[model samples]
Target: MKLQVAIDRVSLGYAVNLAEKLDSYVDIVEFGTSIVKDYGLIEIGHHRPAFKHAELLLDLKTFDEGPYEFEKGFDAQADILTVMGAAGADTLAGVHKVAQNRGGDLFIDLMETGTDKIAQISGFTDAIYGIHHSHDAVAGFDAVATVADFHEQFPNVKRISVAGGIDLPTAERLAKQGIAESVIVGSKIIKTADPVAAAKKFMEVIK
Candidate 1:
């Protein structure tokens, strides 16, 4: 399993610094949507860390103007860019092509999507399908059960990633379950006093 650490709602310098520190230890470093919104893609690109090991993911959460947004994200040096599953078929197809042409990866965030929609979009064999829970939602999430259900429903969809309130125990459970390719942890790591040490702890469990 890969550990993807999300850095959100912080200054650009701090986020970059954290990412640089965790670069060698983790599989992916994510610049959360808040980071992108706080500091535009131009500034982010100009100051992006030279990741020697991990891939960089920018949570664009793109809902429209698929090709344009994806192109810009790739230019900003994102190895993987996300689009909401709630987007239209045309929009999904557009971004898929853009990612293919640019040789980048597409992550479809199934945040509030229905079963039928997931079934429809499951044909995108190369894209990573993320089983996500809304951060704003008040309910709790069972990461292992959720991933198992998603896998049972869409067995053909490989490269699964899960996110939402994952901690050390949850991360270990998800790793042993072996359904998700990546487990995303945000505040559990970033909100800690020492993010690098926290990230190392998560990396140990996930490994």
Candidate 2:
């Protein structure tokens, strides 16, 4: 499993620094939705902080105007961009096409999406299907169980990624579970006193 470190709820400068620091350790470095909204894609693109090792993922959470949003995101040098699973099929297809043609990847965030909608949108063979748990939700999340159930329900969706409150032990379990292609962790790594050390710990456990 690949490790994705999410940098969020911080200033743009800090996010870039963190991304640069964690580049060699993590497979993907994500600029969370807050970063995009705060700094805007135009600014981010103009001042693109290049990464030599890790791929960059932007959490756009696009609900409409899929093609346009995706175009701008790619222009901003993001290797992977996220679209909401709750979006209409046409919108999903539009963004998926943009990603494919631009040599970028799409991550479909399955947060608060129903089973029927998931079934309808499960055919994007190349896109990463994210088994997400909402940050604001009051309920607890069981990453392992949720992944297992999702696999049973959508056995055909091969490229799976998971996120929300992921820690070292959970990441290890996910790696052992062998279902998710990547695991996203935010506060566990980012909020630590030493984020690089925390990230290395996660990396060691997952490996």
Q: Each model's TM-score?
A: 0.98, 0.99
Extract clashing residue pairs from model 1.
none
- The TM-score that candidate 2 achieves is 0.99
The Cα local distance difference test for each model comes to 0.95, 0.95
Name the regions of candidate 2 deviating beyond 4 angstroms. Answer: none
- For residues 1-207, write the lDDT of model 1, one tens digit per residue: 999999999999999998999998999999999999999899999998889999999999999999999999999999999999999999999999999999999999999999999999999999999999999999999989999999999999999999999999999999999889999999999999998899999989988
Candidate 1 lDDT at 136 equals 98
lDDT of 1 at 74: 95
Assess candidate 1 and give its TM-score to the true structure.
0.98
Clashes of each: 0, 0
lDDT of 2 by residue, 1-207 (tens): 999999899999999988888988899999999999999999888766678889999999999999999999999999999999999999999999999999999999999899999999999999999999999989899999999999999999999999999988899999999999999999999999999999999999888
